[model samples]
Target: MTAATPPARVGPGRATWVWRRWGVALRFERRSVLVCGTLAAVVALLGVLALGTGSLRLSPAEVLSALFDPDADPRARLVVVTWRLPRLLFAVVCGAALAVSGAIFQSLTKNPLGSPDVIGFASGSYAGASVVMLLLGSADYLAVASGSLTGGTVTALLVYALAHRHGVRPFRLIIVGIAVGAFLSSLTSMLLLSVSPQQAMLVATWGAGSLNGLGFEQLRVAAVVLVVLLICAATVVRPLVQLEMGDDTAVALGVNARRARFAGTLVGVALTALVTAAVGPIAFVALAAPQIARRLTRGATTLRIAPAALTGAAVLVTADFIAQRVDLPVGVVTVCVGGVYLAWLLVRQYRGGRR
Candidate 1:
């Protein structure tokens, strides 16, 4: 085993911790931290913008005042506090959770296309939700959320059972998930087909994924879950970084490869399930946030959790703001935007590889 070494220099004025022991090497740079901080500040600024802009536009100054002063402008209070605030929090919290979850899956699978849905959670959530609307005639928010959780749990167990061959192979797990996701999606479609027009419309609207009508209660629950999942992420993140060097290298570095894989899988699925439960499977934030964060920070060798989470928060809040103005579901906007980004990402990756 090697002794704890001092911070090493990476770039000018950038300090890093580089450690090696038991034939394993690990390093961390201060740059990621700095980038994450900047991104967090930007996200906060965006939150203010979200609070300010709408049919009733308040300036950033007014937004801040309304936030702090209970007896501020009555209109600002009504809009900011009772109307827009909870949705903004939902966008930020859910977006960050999805981005972090996506990052975990992408790192786990070593595939850029790796998303929270890659584990079948989206389909499962939809399936559960659709069942609630169609079979049980329950369109209540809590009922839908409960159904989504149950479906996600079923999908997770099924995928694990199919994918486990001695241990969960990353590629195999992804393949199994895709296959099961397709099946679950079909189940949702069948339910949609069989239901009455009113029921179908309800399920369809929810499936389109809206941040509409989110409140303090939902945000409170999501916040607690996200906090716990984040702690789990922190404890297992080092192993994730190590695994990026390859499974053998990860093993040499004292990382439990199977355990890390399962942890990532668990976190990724749970995050997606919770978000889907809250807002109905929001499209593309999870898939794009990590990639955008990596680009913005220029950090290829690290997980970039903070930057990714911030980017997701920014993206979703901005989308929600746009949705508010247009009276469109936030999910629809994300899907449209995500479709373009996904195309661009594929093209860029292809060009880079050819180079």
Candidate 2:
């Protein structure tokens, strides 16, 4: 009882420890929200800027008025509502779709390089679209979307089948993906070579990825697909988080690893297919966005998916803006910008390993 009086004293160390833990948790939540909010804001601002500063050059006020008032100048309203709005929406939707796809694939494979583009899914979709554009001379969104889904799903199934031996192995999956991607790419090249010059040119330009001339219909299709996939992604979020633990641990915690993987892969493939069909396989948004989000959030990997989607939207919209101003393709701008970031990531990984 006498010693209890002395024990009532609070040490500064204990208070400091509690403060630090709480501070860290608070900081993390705030940072995540901040990052996501910043991305969203940037995307919105870019959309406004893109609408105003295109070839026709409407003021921001004019663009806003045109957007809100149906009775605004028909020409300005048509440009904002019919033409540019669709492209802007496509940029946002496709960016988010590709980013989320990359996050899911990276989580499933437990590798940063396990994105659709790296793993042949993108190439497969490209192959499918190429066949439609080059062989059948059809740019119909439905045809392209169907072909892309078919090609990407086939590629993913093959990779999964090849990589599965009792259970999927990450390294084997990556290796198989690279091999499959190479084969598909070669097939695409062969098809391009076999096509007539006009068809080849058309396919090649689309392959390089341009948002030019995209109308409301394409944007609407992509938006519907993206929204559906996003809902699927939400359902699997808890399971995915558990699966990030070791297989045995995840199973013990009641996560059906196989089911989770299947669902995640299916959603991921669908998203990738939609983006590829809509915009011709814009690269690196999927790969880079999740990585950037993870670094920014500094949380467990699973939390990065939404933030990645936002960041991807921002990156793609910004890139599209630059592409339009410079008279270059969206794909070209993304590749150049993402290539630089990717190189930096590789170097950072190398340095971390050394440490």
Best by lDDT: 2
Off by over 4 Å in 1: 1-28, 137-143, 160-176, 351-355
Q: Each candidate's lDDT (Cα)?
A: 0.82, 0.84
Q: So what's the TM-score on candidate 2? A: 0.88
Candidate 1 at residue 90, lDDT? 95
Instruction: Give residue 179's error in model 1 in angstroms.
Output: 3.5
Tens-digit lDDT track for model 2 on 168-265? 88879988998999999999999989978888888889889888888986777778778888988888877877888888999999888889998998
Quote the lDDT for 45 in model 2.
86
* Candidate 1 whole-model C-alpha lDDT, 0 to 1: 0.82
For 125-211, candidate 1 gives per-residue lDDT tens digits of 778877876898786667877887788777877988998898667778778988999999887888788878887887788789898
